[model samples]
Every structure is written in C-alpha cells, then in structure tokens.
Target chain A: MIFDLVIYVLIGIGLFFNILAGIGLLRFPDVYTRLHAGTKCTTFGSIFLIGSVILLGLKMWWEKDTNGSVLALHSALALVAILLTNPVGAHAIARAAHRSGIKPAQAVIDELSEEPMNVTTDERRGGD
Target chain B: MIDVYSTYLIVVIALSFCVILAIVRVLRGPTAPDRVVGVDTINTIVIVSMVAFGTAFREIIYIDVAIVYALLSFISTLFIAKYLQGGEF
Candidate 1:
C-alpha cells in the first residue's frame, strides 16, 4: 500500500514539473533564456518521471512478475540514454546558436562574443 | 477509489498541459534557435511521457518507441547544431 502511494506521488511530481518546463520554455524572453528554461526543467522532470518508472518496475519485480522486470530494466536503460544524450545535445545546440551569431534578445553585452572560441581554444584543438 | 488507470489519466492530463506550454513557446519564440530549443525540450518531455504512457498501458511497445524517439531526436539535434555552425561537413 505504502509502495503504491510512493510511486503515485513520484509520478505526480514528475508530471507536474514537466508541465512547468514546457511553460518556462514558452514564457522565457530570449534564446538563451528559453534554452535555460527548456533544458533544466525537462532534465529535472525526466529524473522524477524515470525514477517513478524505476520504482514501478521494482514494485512489479518484487511481486514476482516477469513482465515487470523487463519494464523496469528497459525503462532504466532509456533513462540512461536520456541522461547521457540530452545535456550534450543541449550544449551542442547552444554552441551552434552562439556560432551562428544568434544573439540573446535584449542583451546588454556579450562577454564571450569571440568567433569560434570553442574551436580556437587549446583544449578543443585535437581533431585528426 | 483512485484506481491505477485514473492515476495514469491524471498524469496524461498534466503532461498535456506541458505540451501546450511548449507549443506556446514554439509559436512565440522570436528566433530560429529559440524555437529549436523549445523543440528540443519538447522532445525530451515527450520521451518521458511516452515512458509514462507505456507504464500506464502496460505495453512494452511504447517504451520501444521512446527509445527510438530518443535516438532520432539526438540525431536531429546534432544536425540542427551543424546547420547552425554553418560549416562544411
């Protein structure tokens, strides 16, 4: 009983934040701001949502259901895939946006306005 | 009695709220990149929701779809990034 309650709560919380992320994405003023809203909110929401699935899977597995184990394991893998790819993809998008000369709206100043900083920086200078 | 399916319904409704909000962003975003960001965020949210829906419906197929969606979105993001960079392949 308690376990089911916990899972329900987790799913509810996850869904709540996912909605907030979508709202933030819409309401933010500029590209950078939108990126901030979209990326962080979605990431946070995904954590809870995936966590709920994991809990559900665990609960099912505990009940000795074969299908439950599969659900839990596959969902975990999907979560891992999301975790690994989402941030990197966001970073790449931000970098590309910066590179393409897409400036933030209503910006005061761009401190890192130099061209291809990622390319010219010594740390990124190793492509064969 | 708050059955399991009802819980799933509530989650779906909540997630729809999010999707609406993202749509607003997509529509209102001033620049292309801003729109892209909104789209990217939507992609992530959708994947999670797909998983939720799969769990709700007790079908493994939705999870499979989510996995495929994740990979495809990743590719799309990379392609968009490359386009933004405006360089040769």
Candidate 2:
C-alpha cells in the first residue's frame, strides 16, 4: 500500500519537472537560459523517474521473483548513465555557445566575457 | 496489490507530449545553440520514457536500450558542441 503511494509521488514529481523543462525551453529568452531549463530539469526529473523504477525493482525482488534482481540492477545502470553524462553535456553546450559568440539575452553582468579566456580556435572561420 | 502499470503508461504519454514541446523550440529557435538545446532535452526525456515503458511492460531489455541510448546521445551532444565551437577535433 505504502510502496504504491511512494511510487506514485515519485512519478508525479518527475513528470512535473519534465514538463517544466519543456516550458522553460520555449519561454526562456536566450540559449544559455534555455540550456539551463533543458539540461538541469530533465536530469533532475530523470532521477526521480528512474528512482521509482528502482523502487519497483526492489519490490519485485522482495517478492522472490527471479527477474527482480536483473531489473533493479539494469535500472541502476541506466540511472548512473544519466547522472554522469547530463551535466558534462550541459557544460559543453554552454561553453560552445559562449565561444560561438551567442551572448546571454538581457544580462545584468557578464563575467566570462570580461576576462576573455584564451581558447584557441581556427582564426579563419571567425567567431560565429 | 495496486497495479501501477497504467501510471507508467500515463507517464510515458506525458513525456511524449513534452517531446513535442521541445520540438517546437527546435523549430522556432533563433540560433543553432537553441536548437541543440532542444534536441538535448528531447534526448533526456526520451531516455526516461523508454525506462518507463520498460517498467510498464515488465521487460528488462528496454531498460538496457535506454542505457545505450543515453550514452550515444551524450556522445552526439559533445560532437555537436565541438563542431559549434569551430575548434579542431
């Protein structure tokens, strides 16, 4: 009884955050902000969603089902993949955007732009 | 025992709706980076949806596929970012 409720709550939270990410992507003014919504919210939401799956796997294992261990283990592996890759991908995208000359929209203070990082790139292409 | 399969199905459907929203951003984005962001978001959501589907259907293989998809998407995102920066790969 209680287990089902917990799973429901996790799913609800995950679904809410995932939807928020989509909304944020559409509503945000600039690329950086959109990346903020796209990357962080989805990553967080995936955690909860996969976490619920992990819970279900545990429940199954508790019931003495043979497939339960496989389910829980594989789900954990997937969750780990999400946790490890999402942030690094976000950072890479943000860095590339800044390097490519896409400025933040309506910014109050710009620190990275001020202290120009000496990133070596092909000079012929020019900053796009 | 309460059945949560329907809940998982609903979650998958809702996530597909979210994918549509991201697709809008991709279509309407002003810049290349914006489109890339939309694609990245879609990838993440799809990964979660796959896992949910696996749970809903009581299949373990779908979860394995999700894991593989997550890794591949990460690679693609990195390559795209590198290409955007115009740096030598």
Candidate 3:
C-alpha cells in the first residue's frame, strides 16, 4: 500500500516539474533563460520520473519476477544517460548561443563580454 | 482505487501535453537558439514518456530504445550547437 503511495507521489512531482518546464519554455523571453527552464527543469523531472520506474522495477524483482532486474538495470542506464547528457548539452547550447551573438535580454552587464575571446569581430560588436 | 496501469497511462498523456507546449514554443520562437531550446526540451520529455510507457506495458525493449534515443538526441544537440558556434570544428 505504501509502495503505491510513494510511486504516486513521485509521479505527481515529476509531472509538475515537466509542466513547469513547458510553461517556462513558452514564457521566457531569451534563449539563455529558456535554456534555464528547458534544460534544468526537465532533467530534474526526469530523475523523479525514472526514479519511480526504477522503484517499480525493484518491486517486481522483489516478487521474484525474472524480467524485473532487466527492467530496473536498463532503466538505470537510461537515467544515467539523461543525467550525463542533459547538462553537457545545455552547456554546449548556451556557449553556442553566446558565441553566435545572442545576448541575454535586459541584462545590464555581461562578464563574458569583457574577455577578448576567439569570437569574431561581428559577434563581439553584437555582444556590446 | 485507481489501477496503477491506468495511472501510468495518465502520466504519458500529461507528458504528451507537455510536448505540445514545447512545440508551441518551437513554432513561435523568433530565433534559432530559441527553437533549439524547444527541441531539446522535447527530447527530454520524450525520454521520460518512453520509460513510463515501458513500465505501463511491462516491455523492457521500450526502455532500451529510450536509452538509445537519449544518447542519439544528445549527440544531435551537440552537433547543432557546434553548427551554431560557426567556427572550424
């Protein structure tokens, strides 16, 4: 009984954050801010969602079901992939966005703009 | 009490709604990076949905596919980012 409750709670939390991610994506004005919402919220939400699945699989395995271990292990693999990839992808996209001349909206100062990096003259001008 | 299987289905449905929301951003986004952000969000949600679906149906293969999809999507995101960077790769 409690097992079911735990699963329900986890699923609810995951759904809530995922929905928040969607809303943030729509409402945020800049690519960087949207990346903030799109990347982090979804990654956090996926952890919960997949964590529930892992618990469910473990429950099945506890009952001596043969396939449950496969379910749990493979789900763990998937979760790991998400954990590892999401942040790296977000960082890459953010760097690319900044390098390609998209500045943060309504920002008074950008520290990165001060650095004379490898960016083209046009991109540097855009940053300014 | 509601069936757990039914609950899983509900989760998938809700995630589909999230996907629709991201799609709206993708459509309305004025900039390339903005659209890319939407696409990245969609990929993450899809991975979660695949896991939920696998649980609902007791199919291990679906979760395996989700893992593969996650990796491929990550690679694609990186390539797109590199393309946008506009420097020699």
Q: Quality of candidate 3's docking, in CAPRI categories? A: high
Residue A18 of model 3: what lDDT? Answer: 99
Q: Put down candidate 2 lDDT per residue, A17-106, tens digits, no spaces.
A: 999999999999999999889988998899999999998888889999968788889989999999999999999999999999988999
What is candidate 1's lDDT per residue for B32-65, written digit by digit as tens? 7877887888789789878888888889889989
Lowest-sum lDDT 10-residue window in model 1 chain B: B3-12
lDDT of 1 by residue, A1-128 (tens): 88778877878677767877776776677778777778787787788878888888787889999888888888988888898888898898888888888877798867688545555456556642
List each candidate's DockQ score. Answer: 0.73, 0.78, 0.85
**Cα RMSD for predicted model 3:** 5.5
Model 3: per-residue Cα lDDT over B13-44, one tens digit each: 99999999999999999989888999999999
Candidate 2 accuracy as TM-score = 0.92
Q: In every candidate, what fraction of the native interface contacts is reproduced?
A: 0.82, 0.86, 0.91
Report the C-alpha displacement of residue A92, candidate 2, in angstroms. Answer: 0.7
> In angstroms, how far off is A72's CA in candidate 1?
0.4
Q: What is the TM-score of chain A in candidate 2?
A: 0.87
Task: Tell me the fnat of candidate 2.
Answer: 0.86
Query: Is candidate 1 or 3 superior in TM-score?
Result: 3
Clashing pairs in 2: none
TM for every model, in the order presented, reads 0.88, 0.92, 0.93
Q: Pick by DockQ: which candidate is best?
A: 3
CA shift of B3, model 3, Å: 2.1
